[model samples]
Target: MVTPTLALLHTSPVHVPVFEGLRDQDHPGFALRHLVHEDLLARARAEGPEAVADDIQELLVRTVAEGAGVVLCTCSTIGAVAEARAAAVGVPLVRVDRPMAAEAVAAGRSVAVVATLESTLGPTRVLVEEEAARAGRPVDVTTVLVEGAWERFEAGDREGHTRLIVDAVDALEGVDSVVLAQASMADAADRATLPVPVVSSPRPGLRAAVLRCAEGVKS
Candidate 1:
């Protein structure tokens, strides 16, 4: 049965609380839970993408059984695995980009995908292309990876994290909009004052999932 709320199946530890913050405001009915991926992500980086997919599959199977309405994976590194897990489950599973990418396409014909993690770029590109196709619009998606930002966040340096993202995004010469790949990156958006629109997963993803649940209830 489809519940009135959706569960954010987090892939990274940082994403867990970020989504919780969203529920505090925009989505009170939504809940967030996570599966461990630090070790799993490390293994995938050392091994290959297939290895990551296998671990994600196990986590999704367990999370789905726990009565989750939708499984939204937070990390873009394992997006391919996230898609596979979605296919494996009978419920709606959402990747973080599905909404942001769509928003990017809607915002402008050119979109810049900004991420501090190199691992997230591949999936971000795939998501941009997919969303563009669905919108029947051609878009230019540029991916930029900023180093040390993620480390700063891990070390509890919020100011450092904010500075790094603003500086990196400032370098992008011309883009209609910017889409931040991870939930941690959302904090940087408030600090950035760019000529283009800034899109992040936490807001758009939660809004989409909540609306999906709402629509299901009305149906």
Candidate 2:
């Protein structure tokens, strides 16, 4: 039986509370189920995306099979892998970065995809370009990996991670919009005082997931 709950697949434990807060603020009483597999990202980082493809596919299929009408992949590193299994999973699925990428491409011709991990950069950049193509908006996508930021994030220095990301955003000179590749970087969006818009995944992605669940949309 398909439930009304919105299922979220994450690569980090941090997103549990983050999305919980967003849901609490935006959609009180909305049912949510989160599944985190940090090892998928770690192995992908050490090896490559292919290293975790099977794991991501299985996890995604399992998430939907467990009665999730809608599933959202919150990690950009393995987002494409998860989305690829959507057809086989047979449900409304969303990659967190897609909505943010679409917004970034629409905001300007030059979109900068910022990530703390190098593995996240390529997928995110491609996602931005894909969104641009879908919107018929030509975009110059640039991938920027903020050095040393991931260390801070992994070390549990949340403030340091946000500070580095915010600094990176502030340092960017010529960009139509900045897309935060990982949902963990959402805090930096508010911390950034850039002239150009700073896009983050959690808000728009969760909103899209909630809407999908409400309308029973299949994507």
Q: List the residue pairs that clash in candidate 1.
A: none
lDDT for model 1 comes to: 0.76
lDDT of 2: 0.88
Runs off by more than 4 Å, candidate 1: 1-5, 29-31, 215-219
Candidate 2: worst-modelled 10 consecutive residues by lDDT: 83-92
Query: Tens-digit lDDT track for model 2 on 1-78?
Result: 343678998889999999999999998888999998889998988998788877777776777778788888898998
CA lDDT of every candidate: 0.76, 0.88
| Cα RMSD to the true fold for all candidates | 2.2, 1.9
Q: lDDT tens string, model 1, 1-219?
A: 455546565545767677777778875645555565677666656775577776677777777678665667666777667787669666567776678889888988888889877777877888898889998999888889888998898798978997999998877778998988877788878778887878888788777777776676777
Model 2 backbone overlap count: 0
